[model samples]
Target: MKGRTIILDHLNGREAAALMLDGQLEDLLIACDAPAPGTIYRAVADRPVKGQGGMFLKTPDGNAFLRQIKGMAPGDELLVQVTGYADEGKAIPVTHRVLFKSRYVIVTPNAPGINVSRSIRDEDRREEILAVVHDTIDTVPHGIILRSSCAAADDKDIADDLISMLALADQVLNDDGKGPETLVEGDEPHLLAWRDWVEPAEVVTDEGSFETHGVLDAIDALSSPRVELSGGAFAYVEPTRALVAVDVNTGNDTSMSAGTKANFAVAKALPRALRLRGLGGQIVLDLAPMPKKDRRGFESALKAALRADSIETTFVGWTPLGHAELQRKRARLPLTELLN
Candidate 1:
């Protein structure tokens, strides 16, 4: 594993932590900010946006977008899940489709199915767990996805989590008279990311962060725009108004294979750096120039590095300048914003 270390660095005056992985700061989840993703809210369709497809929803926490107009109308109460955070007066993206996330499983209300995590690679174990989940899911039209945590969980744990999630969903569904009300608050960002994406072997936190949920250890990494990879390779990250650019350069004193090795090193470290920095939207990686024929190998390495990211990412292929172009979904403000 290229980026395996995990550290929770507490920040000053915030109920949040900077999740550092392999010396890069990845995400910032603040307790006082907008609702976390997976948070369920009871909202009413406040008004329809003119010429736009979706209507604005008034929730207890903030305004959300219900991006369909056909079956929804003003003053109609509905249950929605937060997909991303928003700035003041900006509507957070939301979905009527809800997923109740827990450490072990995600229960979808009124939908009946069982999907296991792709990370669960054991076929026999998957089948066995699927059997367990299937037997546990009864009567409710709820669907379930047994997360990676299920691999370590017993039958009782799975069953209990499932029942609790289902019960919560039912409660949200049956509740009435809502303007903007949070039905459920979500877990901290670090914890959520750890459960959903990277399963770190260890979690280290400073005394302050460990005690008060602050992020102090990741300050330097989160603020710096450079990442030094193994061997003599490094990346200089610059965020511009249009996009973020990463220039990969080789260090002093190298071998004939240094270029290829450096490119491979960048392929591994670049994505981890971008992810940890939470620098999304358009991203361009300027390489140290390699043979066109070897481009595929480098590209594959980059894609493999980002395989575990919870955010959706798309590789737009290489650029004419021997650079790689990619895009990641942007929801909340960049992680860099918090550091500043």
Candidate 2:
């Protein structure tokens, strides 16, 4: 019930990971049936869309669409990485910028250089990691990015991680094969939890961990649109085909500052709600009636909340009719989509 707990489990026979903090479900990642993000493929350019400046690719799985196809021909063969899931009937979204990701390092084949994460500000630690990188990945043609997790890791372990990533990068980039094929499948849920969730937490691998830790009950609450916030405030997050709509309510608070209080609570809770649901794209917020003077505070609160989120979100400013707008990246499939 304190700190964090990373639970490696399965949901409906598919791999799934859950992060719990203070006995509450904080985040989750579930592997879908389609190609996972970060999967590498040797793709052959098929045909280009007329006005979209995009090209369809042929991979072993299926057709993928890559935008920004400069200097690309229809018959050329190149490597691509799956960026995210596709719309219901669209081609899988792929990108030419394929990155080799690992627990401690990320190998960039396009750019060759050694860089450390900005979060590691200690000059001594940075220099120590750099020395390890030089010793392990010397004379490499590809780029190396030392992730922040290496800051507290042992030098030998960091070196080993770098070596592993470098080897994978070399194997994929230097492939001389002619036909289309999947070079590397993306990390499954258990592996993804081990790689990305960097906080110190209890690793719970026992089967039925989800139900035992109340994760299943929390997920059931997520199915409804209503999200109960602190201090008798609540918000409804409903998704439609076009965009997501959120409405905040003061709920039994009759004070003059009730609206402001409710809006602030929504600001702090919105990111986690969207993240757990895997909802993205257009989001419009309708707040309870509040003073126009409180707009700046609301924006600042929401901005601080979104900063902690891993998803890419653009705060597109407030609407003339007193609604907040945001554009979030469609990274993971909606939790509802996977659950249903």
Using lDDT, give the best candidate's number.
2
In model 2, the clashing pairs are none
- The list of candidate 2 runs beyond 4 A from truth reads none
Model 2 is weakest, by summed lDDT over 10 consecutive residues, at 133-142
TM-score of each: 0.81, 0.96
RMSD of candidate 2 to the truth, in angstroms, is 1.4
lDDT of each: 0.72, 0.92
lDDT of 2 by residue, 87-165 (tens): 7788999999999998899999888788999989999999999999888755878888999999888899888888888
Which regions of candidate 1 fall more than 4 Å away from where they truly are? Answer: 1-10, 17-32, 47-52, 87-89, 134-137, 189-206, 209-218, 253-260, 320-322, 331-333
Return the lDDT, model 2, position 124.
94
For model 1, residues 122-205, the per-residue Cα lDDT tens digits are: 998899887786687656467777888887678788888888878887787778754778888877756664555445445666
Give the local distance difference test score of model 2: 0.92
TM-score of candidate 2 against the unseen true structure: 0.96
Give residue 265's error in model 1 in angstroms. 1.8
The candidate that wins on TM-score is 2
